[model samples]
Target: MNENKFIQLLKKGDEKAFETLYNEYASKIYGLLRSYLKEDEIEDALQDVYVRIYRGIKGFKQRSKLSTWIYKITVNTAKNYLKKQKKNYLSLDFNLEKNKFTSKENVEKDVFDEIDYEFILNSIEKLPPLDKTIIKLRDIEGLSYYEISKIIDKPVGTVKSRLHYSRKKLQKIIEEDQNEGNG
Candidate 1:
């Protein structure tokens, strides 16, 4: 079924529609949450996101795409969970040793790759929650600035500025890593 029809069914409280929506979007939502939450926290956050989606579907005015609306709910729900727990949501424990390349040659080859995943993830973890969310939505999720503005309930200009600052901060972090490697 088309998205509009599905959404209409959802708004009407169709059980099958809910199931379909969950099946389609649950993994995407979970993946998005993984960037902002720890493994243990994601399931709880996912439940909360669905609850919000179900309850708020009636009020969804179609100002944005359904996917964007769902993403906004997921992001907000995860943020709320983190806030309640009073912990840094972006701090993920990455075991560098386990991820190490087996050979020195391989390590060197991978290190010089265009983007360093570890460095990028580490830098993202250090960002403030809002900046981190903005960067993730814009760069990682490939959301347009306008879509992001709607999700975060910020003006488009504010969204752009935050994304710009986040990118600059990430660039600085990458440059610092390079400098340290050279030194």
Candidate 2:
């Protein structure tokens, strides 16, 4: 179905429409949430995001694309959840050491490959919440600046600047990690 028709069905409280919307967007939303939230909190955050999406669909003004509106709802819902729980957004529990890659057979791979993945993730986790969110939206999710601005309720210029700063921060983190490993 077309987006307009789907949204109209949603506004009318159609159950199938809700299911369809959920099916369409669930994975992306889950991935986005997973980037910021702990494993235990992701499911709750996902539920809250969908609930807010359903409840707010009727009031959606269509000023932006439906997906953008949903993204905004997801970000806001997750942020609100964090605020209510008094959780530190900067603290991510990756537990990379405990969760080693399991392989049935011993496979020889380059050491560089393994280190880079965890190093990059740890670097990103160390970023402030706003920078992390901007990086996820722009770099991971591949959202345009305008879309990210809408989702985060920032101006496009601000989004661009933050994205630039976040990228630089990530680069510095990666460089520091590499230097430490080399030394």
Candidate 3:
């Protein structure tokens, strides 16, 4: 079924449509929540996000894609969760499970790649929340600048510049870490 029709069903409080929507978006929203929340908080936050989505579906205007609207809701819910928890910092818990490589050469390469990837994620976790979020939305989640702008409620230009600046900052952090490790 088309998303519009699916959304209409959601608005009408159809249980099957709600189930389909949950199946489709739960994991993606959970992953997005992980970027903003802690392990203990994730399950609760995910529930809260879906609850809000279910209740707010009737008010959803089609100015954005359903995915984008869902993402925006998730971000807001995460921020609200953080505020409610009295936490001053947002942490990125990106799941970078190591891939199994078959050949010896591939195994060696993948080990080094995982090491570097882990290092970068550690560095990114040290960044301010907004920068971390932009980096995650753009690089990890593969969201477009426009989509990110809507999700974060910023202009497209702001999202682009923040993403650029965040990338540069992450690069500098990685370089510093490398230099210190070498030294």
The number of clashing residue pairs in each candidate reads 0, 0, 0
lDDT by residue (135-181, candidate 3, tens digit) is 77776666788999999989999988787777667667767888899
- The candidate 3 region of ten consecutive residues with least summed lDDT is 100-109
Look at candidate 2 and tell me the lDDT of residue 140: 53
Name the candidate that leads on TM-score. Answer: 3
Model 1 Cα lDDT, one tens digit per residue, 1-183: 888898899999999999999988887788678767889998889999999999999999997899899998987887887789897746443323223212112322343355556666765676776776776666556688899998889999999778777666766776787788889
TM-score of 1: 0.75
Those runs of model 3 whose alpha carbons end farther than 4 Å from true positions after fitting are: 96-115
lDDT of 2 by residue, 1-183 (tens): 788898999999999999998888887787667656667888898988888887888899999989889888887777776788797654443323333322111221232236555566677777887887787666555678899999999999999888777767766776787888899
Candidate 2 vs candidate 3: the lDDT winner is 3
TM-score (C-alpha, index-matched) for candidate 2: 0.76
lDDT, candidate 1, residue 95? 28
Report every candidate's CA lDDT.
0.75, 0.74, 0.79
- Superposition error at 53 for model 2 (Å): 1.2
Q: On a 0 to 100 scale, what is the lDDT of residue 86 in model 1?
A: 90
Clashing pairs in 2: none
When 1 and 2 are scored with lDDT, the better candidate is: 1
